[model samples]
Target chain A: MPYFAQLYNFACWLIGDRVAAEDLVQETMLKALRGFSSYQQGTNFRAWIYRILRNTFLTSQTGLKATASLDSEDDALPEPATLETPESILLVRHEQSAIRSALESLPIDFREVILLSDVEEMSYQEISQALGVPMGTVMSRLSRARKAMRGLLTAASEGVKR
Target chain B: MTCDTWRERLDAYIDDSFPPEELNQLEEHLRVCPSCAAEALHRLKLKHATKAAAAARFAPSSEFRSRIAQGMPSRRKRLFGDLWIPGLAVAAAILIALAGSSVWEWHAQRQQALAELVDLHVTTLASVNPVDVISTDRHTVKPWFQGKLPFSFNLPELENSPFRLLGGKLVYFNHAPGAQLLCASGKHQISVFILQGDWKFALSGTFPASAREKGFNIESTRSADLRILLVSDANPGDIHELAELLKAAQQP
Candidate 1:
């Protein structure tokens, strides 16, 4: 049951729609069951399940939307904010909703890295395998993803201050 | 580490990906470099806030949990799951084991038989005496086997076909005397081995049983009183075509 909830939460974040997330999680469960024999024991079970779910999403209609949106790589690595630290802003006071909206507005790729790194706390190795990318790609993507996320959150907070 | 390098690695540092020695170096840099220190602090705050917000936002609803529970598959159905017949399960188990071994043995024998037939094909191609009657004429090849075998078989006319009649030989399969007609398609040689028997019992097949082993395509069929097996390394499609031709021309 805990496993299902975790998967559901991840799925909900990935697709950003409740009904679609439920259906995606259910399909992931079905595929995991059917191909369970191929899954070797004494391995990262969580990573294995996440990899399956990730693959299912990639090939799905929603995943296609995510892939299509990834084509606009112009803003993939936004410039880092170099202004003096806004210490007077007390960012954490307004961070909860600002950060959530920031994550919600970000592209699927950036959101994926943040969710894996910050939310799930998956290791770099596990993230590489789960996302089916090279280790170096995971590092660079995660770096860019975090930078992009901060940009979003900063922008949201600035807009709210106005 | 320089500020630029530390900037590139700030996320990894916070994610604790750096080795302890490198981490110590970065922390030493952070102590002196207030800019790098401030950047790390902001990154840490951002990571913390995002984790908390994502956790609070994406919790699966109770209804979703119930849906998943309902979708969970039950244990796979077993043959003896419900019914408990007196001594039935034991008898079934014994019968299954015997049947399994026999089926495996039968499959092994069939594979061995195909291998032997393939060997015969290779050896015949190399042998000096490939056929008892070496003739391309169907009329001559068809009659040369009379009185030598218990049954007669039809030979397809290959006058204009890609397959040319090379010759025919007398062969044995399972101690049963049969006719082996050797034919050719371009560079490939084809051997058709025919055994005489009650067609239905000998074949137990209405259609040709085809297999490929040891680089040879083999097709077996029953036509009239002959159990015909064709072996070749030629194209599989061509083998089936020749098999169909032989099946069509056999005397009813």
Candidate 2:
């Protein structure tokens, strides 16, 4: 039962629509239940279910759009490690909004890395298995994603300053 | 090693997944290079803030939950010639109800109330304007709910706490009016619901102190004749801090 909430949250973030995310999670659950026997013992079950959810997303319309943008160089954010993360940034309302909008505007690939690493707190290996990507790719994507997030936050705070 | 190489490793280090040898090198570099150290700090802060901002999320309603539960593939039904086992189970349930109906009803009612509370938490957060009485002062908000709800709950002193009193509003549960006190903890808004604790379906005192539903954490406790239920997406530690503060304030 708890699995449903986490899956639904993951699906919602991927699809960007509440209604669609519900349907996606329901489908994922059904598929998981029917294929329970196929799941081997002692494997990373969370990673396996996430893989199913992500795979399901990859076939959906929103996912196709994200796929198209995956290689689009124009969507890449500048590397921004210079910005300070002074815990108080989120304490302020505008800064909080800035962080959220920055996330929501990110390319789906970047967004997923941020979510998996930071929000879901999945390991590199687990994330690798879930996304069907190699460990190195997970590392690179997560690195770039954080850099991009930092970049956006910096820009948003500067905009507020003006 | 160059800072660029160290930068790449810092990301891995922040996740605490790097090897000991690599960590020794990274730690050595961090001591020498202020810029690299600052960059690492930036990533840590970003991860924390991102997690906080992404806290409030949606969950399926109770209807959808039961639909999934009932719809799960029953291995027994598959093996026992279809309806045969289900029919017998229902007969057994009827016999049990006749024997101790309150026990059966207790479980169902508790689940339903918790689900409804979570629903209210989500719905209130989603709505454009959440509370009727909007004030950050505990003195102001506590009195506002005095007449609106059947029971009163003490609003904790949040001066040194992570939470701040948001306000209160009247909410109905199972057609009974209750007080919903909203509190802000960082980026997350925690709802403290005080309802008549003496209702027929009183919690068994063994209610799990905390449970997560639809992305939010729901914690329940009883103070006098009032049931204090809190719902939020704040970090668990922060939730516990606020819960302790509330528990202290509810003291007679």
> Which candidate number maximizes TM-score?
1
> What part of the reference interface contacts, as a 0 to 1 fraction, does candidate 2 reproduce?
0.29
Put down candidate 2 lDDT per residue, A1-162, tens digits, no spaces.
446777877777778877677666765664454334345568788887886677556545566566655644334575544435533354365656777788887878788888888878899988977765558768987877776777777666666667
Model 1 agreement with the true structure over B50-158: per-residue lDDT tens digits? 7777874666677767655655422333222221222333344335545665543344346445644664565456444467689999999989989978878888888
Each model's DockQ? 0.15, 0.13
What is the per-candidate TM-score for chain B?
Answer: 0.56, 0.59
After superposition, candidate 2 runs with Cα above 4 Å error: A73-75, A81-95, B72-252
Q: By DockQ thresholds, what CAPRI class is model 2?
A: incorrect
Regions of candidate 1 where Cα sits further than 4 Å from its true position = A72-78, A83-90, B72-252
Candidate models: Cα lDDT each: 0.69, 0.69
What DockQ would candidate 1 receive versus the native complex?
Answer: 0.15
Q: Candidate 2: which pairs clash?
A: none
